[model samples]
Target: MKAALWYGKKDIRVEEIEEPKVIKGNVKIKVKWCGICGSDLHEYLGGPIFIPVGQPHPLTGNVAPVVLGHEFSGEVVEIGEGVTNIKVGDRVTVEPIVACGKCPACKEGKYNLCSLLGFHGLCGSGGGFAEYTVFAEDYVHKIPDSMSYEQAALIEPIAVAIHSIRMANFNTGDTAIVLGSGPIGLATIKCLKAAGASLVIVLQRKSIRQEYAKRAGADHVLDPNEVNIAEEVKKLTGGLGVNTAFETTGAKIGFDIGIDSLKYGGTMVITSIWEGEMNFNPNVLVFSEKKIVGTLAYRHEFPATIAQMSDGRIKSDGYITKKIALDDIVEEGFGTLTGPEKKKHVKILVTPDKSLLSD
Candidate 1:
């Protein structure tokens, strides 16, 4: 079997590896497609953050230099003892978070915040970058027959968007702004529209991303460099300002703009993970009664996301900008995602099985 192994900063290698085997209560999947995520790029550039050195994961107990990739979908190849819900040839996408069900957060139904939560790609599960990976049966959800593998591969991120929108508590008539045009940001816009948002605006510097945002149902796409986004949003909303804003760019400037563009008493959902702290104005939030909320990964939304995809409601084709083989995992896959050429790229899917590659 072949897999993408993380060696260190800017050093992910594709090499031959032993195929994974099914364990009790787990199911082994033959990975078809895995998406290169922003966090994977972060780890590739400046890592050992979530991945520990000289030790195993605190929760999963799997160590560093493991197989990479988490956003993926595959076909079930084998099932371990006690796994009855899934069987061979079943297509599914995995929920990568393995949580300790006894934790307070898990007990409270907030498994994403489980005290002993461990993510598959990050902690020690050795994710879908490999030819085959095993996951708990409970973590794998069957995809509808109408959904393509690429669309199934996206359910994880869509669930993240769903959770973020739920955190915002957006109403049908609400006006909202999404401060990034990346996969998650654009997915947020799609979810916002599906939830009945009257107006959904997107702020992005890259023209390609802006165009993608428009195609993904953004009511208005603004280039921050070309126009005053805050002022334009104010005008569009008849001067009351947008009722909600999402800061998905993980940049100080994006954060500041999100705050400035919100209506009084509106909420801003920070979906991107920042590497460092940024200056935020406390007085503005205090005076306006505006709220800033943070969303982590998804919880219990995969089935609903799959349902949306099955019904052809959430179109993921516009977001998948590129597809590459496992052999080109370094150059054509991750390189196109994080390099200077990223301005034109959106979601890049990697296929371990070259037979599935499309023209």
Candidate 2:
């Protein structure tokens, strides 16, 4: 089977490797479509964020140069012993999180906060970038027949957005501002609208992304470069800021926009996986009586998100901007996503089955 593995910073190789076989309590999926996530770009540019290097990941027990995709969906080809709910020929999408079932967080039904949290694809245990990969049956979810393979691949990201919104103290009819308009940021907009947010304002500088932000259900897309983000947000809210702010940019400026543009006592949800340390003053939160909530991966959000997408409560369309074969992953997938033309894309889906590319 051909798989794309991350060697190090800016190095992703597409090479032939032994196909993964289903193990006990696992299911093997034939790759259909896998979205190249922003986290994958982070590892490719400034690595080891979630990818293990010096020491093995506590969960998967594997190190760097492992398979490198997770936001994916596929068809089940085989199921290992003891896997009951899932069977062969089922269309499924993986939650992609690996947690110790006995951990405190897991026992408390907050496994996304597991002490030694790791991801299946990023940490090890094979990945969706290959033609075939095996994952525990628990994380493999069946998708409804109404969902296409491309949309099924987007469930992971949409689930992330739903989780973040569910974590915030945001209420229906409350206004919110989202900093950054990447795939995750755009997904946040859709989730916020679906959650009944009254007004959705976006702060994005990229022209194309600004357009995409509006398409994602943002009521007003403002360029931070032209006008002050905090000022404009206040104007829109009649001297008060948005009730909630979503920080999805992971940049220092995004942090500032997320906090400064929120109404007093508002809640800001940090959803981005940052690359480096950020400087902050505790006084900002103290003076305004505002609070911040941090959300990680989705926990039990897959099924609900799938149902929402299936029933049209949450629209999932037009996010896929590019598709490429595994052989062209390095240049067409990673490079293009991070290169000069990066802003032209919203989500890029990769497939190990080259035949699908021709389709």
State in Å the error of residue 301, model 1: 0.6
- Model 1 clash pairs? none
Residue-by-residue lDDT tens digits, candidate 1, 1-359: 99998888888999998888899999999999999988788789878766656877777777767888899999998999999899999999999997989989999999999887777877877788889999999989999888888888888888889999888888888889999988899889889888889999999985688788998899999888899999999999999889899988989878888999999999999999887778766998999999999999899888888888788677776888888899999999878877778978878899999989854
Clashes of each: 0, 0
TM-score for each model: 0.97, 0.98
Q: Give the TM-score of candidate 2.
A: 0.98
Q: Per-residue alpha-carbon lDDT of model 2 for 103-215, expressed as tens digits?
A: 88899999888888888779988898999999999889999998999999999999999999989967899999998999999999999999999999998995799889988
Best by TM-score: 2
* Colliding pairs, model 2: none
Q: Whose lDDT is greatest here?
A: 2
